[model samples]
Target: MSGEREPVSREESSTVAAVQEEAEAVALVPELLISDLLRYGVLLSLSLVTLGTLVTFLRHPDYLVSSEALQRLTAPHPVPHGLRDVVVGAMAARGQSFVMAGLLVMMAVPVMRVGLSLLIFRQQRDTVYVAITTAVLALLGLSFLLGAAE
Candidate 1:
């Protein structure tokens, strides 16, 4: 306790700091490259599925109903029972169509994240930053998809 310690060299100090920073990043799952890859892939897949649904809607255009129109159609009416079924079906389809559209948009979020990751890596070659960015993109995309489904 009485003896003075020698000063750390600049190189040694910087290396130790770098190592500590890396260790902290390693402690977070989202700070790993594999995590980012998983997110990017999942988002891309969800978007594709959504796009497919949109295409199906396009092919079956006769059933599509805007929200305003659906509300109007669902209003109580003194119509034949069969006609009521038609209105109800249309209302359901309207919601499904919107959900599919939202999924498509959500998918784009992951793709955008991938691009940002690449840019970050190019600028600094830091895997932790890439992983974090990708993870964020994935979570946002998933949230969008889930919200849209509802």
Candidate 2:
């Protein structure tokens, strides 16, 4: 037989192109998800903080107190222990609660990004990455548990 190749069929070429496109899209999912998570998290948190600040200024025009008084009022406090308390406090227009919620959301974004990574690694059957992601998740959980214990 001659060494020359036969002309490729259009259907076969189209199929190969489609498969390549799918592979490229699949490879981009994790990156896209991470970027979107970071973008949305920051945006949402900023919105919440801004809204809280506006509400505080509007509701309490005399909120501008002495530095010492402001420091005392904004002193570090433990997070609400229960969801109900947080939700109720936020609904009641508690500026601190809104700010706390925003901070919490900001913190959660990275954890969620890690979780998405773990899932993607698992789906791709990447054992090394899966193990690494799992360890990271474990450490994150441990930190939260230890912090809560304090």
- How many residue pairs in model 1 have overlapping backbones? 0
The digit string of per-residue lDDT tens for model 1 on 73-94 reads 5898653223345345335664
lDDT of 1: 0.60
TM-score of each prediction: 0.31, 0.77
Q: Give the TM-score of candidate 2.
A: 0.77
Model 2's number of clashes is 0
Highest lDDT: give the candidate number: 2
The alpha-carbon deviation from the true structure for residue 107 of candidate 2, after best TM-score superposition, in angstroms, is: 0.5
Candidate 2 at residue 33, lDDT? Answer: 86
lDDT of 2 by residue, 102-142 (tens): 77788888999999889989999999999999999999999
